[model samples]
Target: MRVPRRRRDAVEVNLTPLIDVVFLLLIFFMVSTTFETRQALELELPESVSGVAQVSSPVTVVVTAEGDYRLGQRALSADELASRLSDAAPQAREAGLVIEADGRAPHAAVVRVLDRAGALNIRRVRIATAEATHTEAERP
Candidate 1:
């Protein structure tokens, strides 16, 4: 008598659970991530008819209407401002200094900052200003 041979079944892999696990991992990473935000000072720059575009990123010094001085959003005294400018002189010599003074700020304050920048031998100095609009011209 001849013995009957047993037939073998073809093996198959199920991918539904593998795809579900991958999607869960993606969602877990997306929900656990944190984003960083930068701090900035609120300012209203003076307007001018001949305002020019800035080419390089300069060290920004902000003078408020209340006569307060800020460098990169940190408040500092006149002496501190001078020291900071001197420390940054090498980089500023090429990148320049930008004075972002408020419109309501006193002229003397702006001039004082300019004088400080000059003392540091920073020749490339610019006063930040917005372009004058037709409405602004009509108002005055």
Candidate 2:
């Protein structure tokens, strides 16, 4: 029996399929990604009369240095915040809100954020603060 010879041209990979997959992945990420937009705005908060305690499961609301507020990284206006709270899940609504205020932030700014959350039927609100750096133990 005579042996058959192999073809001179080798198989080649098509780039179009790879490009199509990349485009599809790009679109998928754009559509499915959840964006939280508080990186640009910051709110500073004045010290409170009482110490702020940590909560395990709070609806974290960050007040920036500029007094702008964000909820778990999602920015919100006063009215929108109220509306959003009203529309949140039961657990979300019940989840006490932790308001992170910068040291330089005005008291009024922090109050306003709390007021808005209150208006949305949020019962519990907590402010955020780090351990005092000026405590007697740490001082020389």
Among all windows of ten consecutive residues in candidate 2, which has the lowest summed lDDT?
Answer: 40-49
Best by lDDT: 1
After superposition on all C-alphas, the RMSD of every candidate to the true structure, in Å, is 5.8, 7.1
Candidate 2 TM-score to native: 0.54
Steric overlap count per candidate: 0, 12
- C-alpha positional error of residue 83 in candidate 2 after TM-score superposition, expressed in Å: 1.9
Number of the top-ranking candidate, with TM-score as the measure: 1
Could you give candidate 2's per-residue lDDT for residues 42-126 as a string of tens digits? Answer: 4434444457566555467666666666666577876666666566635556777677778776667788877777666767767
Error of 2 at 48 (Å): 7.8
lDDT of 2 at 23: 100
